[model samples]
Target: MKIITLIRGTIRELAAKATLYVLAGISTLMLLAAALAVGADSTPDGKTITFFGKQASPPVTNEMLADLAGKLEAGFAGGLFLGIVVFGVFGTAGVIPDALEKGTVDLYLSKPIARWQLLLGKYFGSVAVIFLNIIYFIGGLWLIVGLKVGVWNGRFLLSALLLTYVFASLYSVVTFFGVLSRNMAIAIIAGILYLLLVAGPLDSRQAGLYLISENGIYRGILDGLFYIFPQIPAMESGAMHIIAGEHAEAAPYAQSFLSSGGILALSAWILHKKDF
Candidate 1:
């Protein structure tokens, strides 16, 4: 009951700030633009596609249509994956630091709830915020593309869950830094930098780095760091594969899930021991 209350309070607090409204507005605009810009006509022969009322090309064959649908879904999924990661991190980065504020922490600690419960509430609450927006954005896109373009790609909807998982993993880092630093900027920066610099570059360049480096010690260290961080690129490519209706590797997602769980546990332990 206490955790549920906290989650509700967190949602109400964030909603009051217009965060949810702003995200929803962006989603609505995207959906509206897609509806206006994308059009298709199917005749007895083939299908014709248009953008902004301008014909994209001559009528395309059924095979071409299938290829186009796969590319379209994959493109949207990739773009949304990146967009959600950036905006989601910025949106929820302040939750922990704000909660750690002097009077705020005092009020929360005064309750009979355990510290881990408090942390979990904040963590889940922030995730809930992003989860709602993700569904809105991805679901809107799915509907628009399916209804307007005559392409019903059910696998595309999986991007919503994939995007949420990525954000949750990233948020664990944000929450850990927020609790440790009690500064929103540090928390936000840490999450973004980890995504851009650490996880992204390492995952992309790991093979090349291993090939170039002769030092066994250096290679071992790189391998250790590789396993330590979330395999975002792998997860991303896996998501693309899934969106394209192909088989995706499961190891990256599994490793990322474990890494996120470990980080969250560490954050809870730190919060439990820290003096308010």
Candidate 2:
């Protein structure tokens, strides 16, 4: 019950700060643009695609609509995933650091709540904020594409959950760094650098690294780091596969989930032991 109260309080605090409005405004604009830009006309023989009423080159056959729809869905899902990750990180990075401020921590600790519970509540409150925006943005996009493009791909909706999980995974790193350094800038930079540099580049260049280095120790360390960090690239690829209605591997999701769990647990432990 205390945790629930803390979660609600966090949500209310965030809402009061207009974070929800900012995110929702961006989502609404995207949906509006999609609605205005996309159009489809169907006949007995085939379908004609249009952008702003200009006919797309080479009319699409009825048989190709499914393939085209799948591609469109995947493309939109990918864009949303990227946007949410970037924006979610920037928006919520301050959550933990702000909570850990001198007076704020003192006031929070004065309550009957356990330190871990307080940290978990703040963590989940941030997640809930992102979750709601994901639903709003993804759901609005789904509706726009379904109604305008004449393709109601249900699989695209699942991307919302997958994207939320991805954010949660990355946000765990932000939370860890936030707890460690008590600096919002550090938290934000850690999440962004991990996404852009560590996760994407390292995952893609693993084979190249192995080729460049003959040292067994180097190779072993590389492989160990690969398993230690959240498997973001693999998980992202799996998300795209799922969006495209293909079989997605489970290992990436499992690896990421475990790494994120471990990181969050460590953050909570650190918070518990920290001198307020």
Candidate 3:
């Protein structure tokens, strides 16, 4: 009964702002559409506005344009802006530590709820809002691209969903980190630094120099270090294919299950033994 109430109430709160939350995606698609109308790909590279390397440069079609738009959106808009911008900045990093720092757990844990249940519930609540925003955003983009280009891209829809799920999984891991710290700024900083160590290039132009080296030994060291973090780009291959209006076979579903399951396990393991 308690779990049911928690899930229901949490979902209700998130659903209240579903439309407002989705605006990010809607705004992005509109901008892409306008860019399409005005020849967004007419740059020096000519990769976007392709003319088959022919004279007079053939007119741009929607299929070709949609393909270009989907690719850029998957990597840039979907990955960096939506995943990093909204989820990282507004959702996970903001919510978790804020809840703990403000002593919101006192109110939550008082309800005969186990600490793990409380943590899981909180994770679900925040994730719901972010999920609605991303999935619909990417799904709508695919629909728009298909209409403009006269190509069916159902696979793109699936890829977009899978990618968002992976992002959500990463956010869950970060959220648990925030909860462990119980200080908003501290948690965010920790997450940033931890991710830098886990995922950022070991060999860089700056301070991460300890991670950089041209020697085979250094390369081996870097590979060993980075193998710990889940490879997000591999999960992105399906979306890359959707840009081409075809589906590519990959292990995204299996990867998502493992990563998300790992996050849930870690969060539970930590919350179980730690004092609130």
Q: What's the lDDT for all of these models?
A: 0.82, 0.83, 0.55
Query: Model 3: which residue pairs collide?
Result: 63-149
Taking the tens digit of each residue's C-alpha lDDT, what string does model 3 give over 107-190? Answer: 776678886676666677666655566666666665555554344566556665665665665565576677677665665665
Give the clash count for each candidate: 0, 0, 1
The sequence of per-residue lDDT tens digits that candidate 1 reaches over residues 3-118 is 99889888877887765677778778877888898778876678977789887756899667656776676887787777777677777888999998999999999989888888
- Using all chains and alpha carbons, the TM-scores for the candidates as numbered come to 0.92, 0.93, 0.67
lDDT of 1 at 29: 84
Sum up the clashes in candidate 2: 0
Q: Which candidate comes out best when scored by lDDT? A: 2
> Candidate 3: how large is its RMSD?
6.1
Task: Report the Cα lDDT for residue 178, model 2.
Answer: 96
Q: Over the full model, what C-alpha lDDT does candidate 1 score relative to the true structure?
A: 0.82
**Candidate 2 vs 3: which has more lDDT:** 2
Candidate 1, residue 34: lDDT: 80
Cα misplacement distance, residue 213 of candidate 3 (Å): 4.8
